[model samples]
Target: MDNITNEEKQQSIEAFQSVIRKSENALASMKSGSAQSRLLEKRLKAARIGEGLLAARWEGKELDVSHDELVEAKQVLEGLLLMLPGFLEKTKPGSGQRTYIERRIKAFQMAVSYLNE
Candidate 1:
């Protein structure tokens, strides 16, 4: 994503919007206290952050994220980092899923570092 062209970033922003809408719809259908709803909420938040990141990039500027939002994103991503290793271990070595998980881990680490800064 760091190397994506402007056109690609625009597409990513659109994709993130779609995810946010769908996640919102799904969240509406779930029980308020259900684990699924909680997970969906997190997904929605992540999509929003991703979209904002892309939008800022498109505008040729740094993201103007709020302190609280950055903290929330960092917490969510750190939680995901804790869980991803289990899934990564289950995938076969050299598999596409494995590679994807690896990349995702790296991306999350980078995001956490950026947020910290």
Candidate 2:
């Protein structure tokens, strides 16, 4: 982070925003009880994992946990980083995407805050 150029950081931030918006829209537009609902559910889970990864990057100091907890967090973060690209490309975006994604992000923050305690 210290060595990252300003331009690079800005680019990363913009990419992060794009990923978030695309993933959220896709996750939210998915219809419940559809044949592919289960798959959509999985994609939502992966996006939440990505949200956690980004949050940890920007808020690492506030996220104190045990070594085992840290390990679990790292695994989730890595999984999100790996899965996000394919998931984003595969899922079609819709109007309702942001609502569900935002709800999940709030829930995720609550869950992780408990781990910190």
Candidate 3:
């Protein structure tokens, strides 16, 4: 339990991409080119910053970040969450998607805690 396994890293990447895809679909139904939609795109990019550390695993290559790296990456993601607008937090894309993001944030927090231990 000292570090996250490669499988865990891959799972995290998959989960991240899953949400991104869901967000994309959700965004698409809105105006083709709207402010909130654009902001969601930008937020997705910011959220995916940690995926770089796990890209090799996601791609089936020979690489993955260490426990400390995972912790740092999680911190980056948490920071990104903090920077999101209050409207996005309350009711822009609606409840389900927002809850998903909130759950993902919690999941990341738990993963970081586990990796740290």
Task: Give the TM-scores of the predictions, in the order they appear.
Answer: 0.64, 0.39, 0.47
**Model 2 error, position 75 (Å):** 2.6
Q: Mind giving the per-residue lDDT tens digits that candidate 3 earns over 1-117? A: 236666666566666777667777877787866898876765555445444534643455643546555555566566655654453466546577675555465445544443344
Q: Tens digits of per-residue lDDT for model 2 on 1-117?
A: 335455544444444455557756775677867766665555445444434544565555443445664556544434544544554455456635443344343334433443344
Which predicted model would earn the best TM-score?
A: 1
The full ranking of all candidates by lDDT, starting with the best, is: 1, 3, 2
Candidate 1 lDDT at 116 equals 68
Off by over 4 Å in 1: 1-33, 54-60
In the predicted model 1, the residue pairs found to clash are none
Clashes within 3 Å, all models in order = 0, 1, 0
Pairs clashing in candidate 3?
none
Off by over 4 Å in 3: 56-76, 79-103, 106-117
lDDT of 1 by residue, 5-108 (tens): 66554545555566678889999899998989988898679767866765665577787778788788778877877998999989999998786677666556
Off by over 4 Å in 2: 32-73, 80-117
Q: Candidates 1 and 3: which is better by TM-score? A: 1
